[model samples]
Target: MKIRVSDLISRKERSKKIDYKFEIPKFEFEGDVITPVSKCEVSGVITSDKDIVIMKAKVTCTLEMNCSRCLDTFIYPIDIDIEERFANNNSLENEDVIIVLDDILDIAQVVESNIISSLPIQRLCKSDCKGLCQECGANLNKESCSCNNDDVDIRFDVLKGFFDNKEV
Candidate 1:
């Protein structure tokens, strides 16, 4: 995931093509594990303008993730476009710029960070997932349940009591 940029910095090369494929280890986010099912593929180019180096790349990968609703495993595919800036001097250090050290750029962190941020907060197996029944702990998407789910909110208890005390 590291690329040599001495030629670009020295004005010897205007741009360099990048194509790499690598594996990523499983990592945990919140309480779920995100495991990569395929090799991460990155393809793009890095160009130099004055003292600044810009990298634009497209990354693709598939991950095994659990649905937050039904807790079922599903394949989550990712296709992201990334653009990053780098400089040889520390003066360019900021939110959008990375300082390249030792004439080499290590892009593994950048790629992983982009992938993690792109994940959905609530992963669902389908767009209309039925989730599970809170009363009987049964999967509503699979079968029907007889458990009573008519419970009312505690804030309405006073109204319920007033109606219960009335006589017809």
Candidate 2:
């Protein structure tokens, strides 16, 4: 969502409080689709300190994601704290600083970035999920596999033959 900072820029007020709620459509990242289950809520206060505008906001949203292990879909809730600074003038050349343009501040990019970074690298359906069995592509969590459990690696066959020929 976009927030107007015209009043603050005009020096009418030293600070302004903002509270916004918006819906985020499903977005794809790295071939994975992330869909939000509900509206995202953001509430914060923006303060103008000299030529800089500082914003601190709390964002909360619930997302639907697939488990990396079992591919099961689940709902994940996220809460993130954001602190950003915008330069009212062009004197600041830091790459990390966001420049305000036309007395408008767009927070959609910031919110999307924070949510993506907050996601876990590996998502599991459960703590001890057995996952899929390599032998017959069976789900180990649901049933036991009848595949041979004592299959030996071919790389160790030479060593096995040498040991078998020697008497203990």
Identify the leading candidate in terms of lDDT.
1
Task: Give one digit per residue, the lDDT tens place, for model 2 in 1-168.
Answer: 666665565686778776888888899766779899999998898887776778899999999987776667778898989998887567764746688767678877777787888888887667797777678877777788988766679887667678668887
Q: lDDT by residue for model 1 over 1-168, one digit each (tens)?
A: 787666687766689888988898999988999999999999999898877889999999999999899788889999999998888877767646788788778878778888999999999889998888898888888898998887789898668778668898
Taking all chains together, each candidate's TM-score versus the true structure is 0.86, 0.80
Q: How far is candidate 2 from the true structure (C-alpha RMSD, Å)?
A: 2.8
Our tally of clashes for model 1 stands at 0
| Whole-model lDDT values for every prediction | 0.86, 0.79
**Candidate 2: residue pairs that collide:** none
Sequence-dependent TM-score of model 2: 0.80
Query: Candidate 1: misplaced stretches above 4 Å?
Result: 158-168
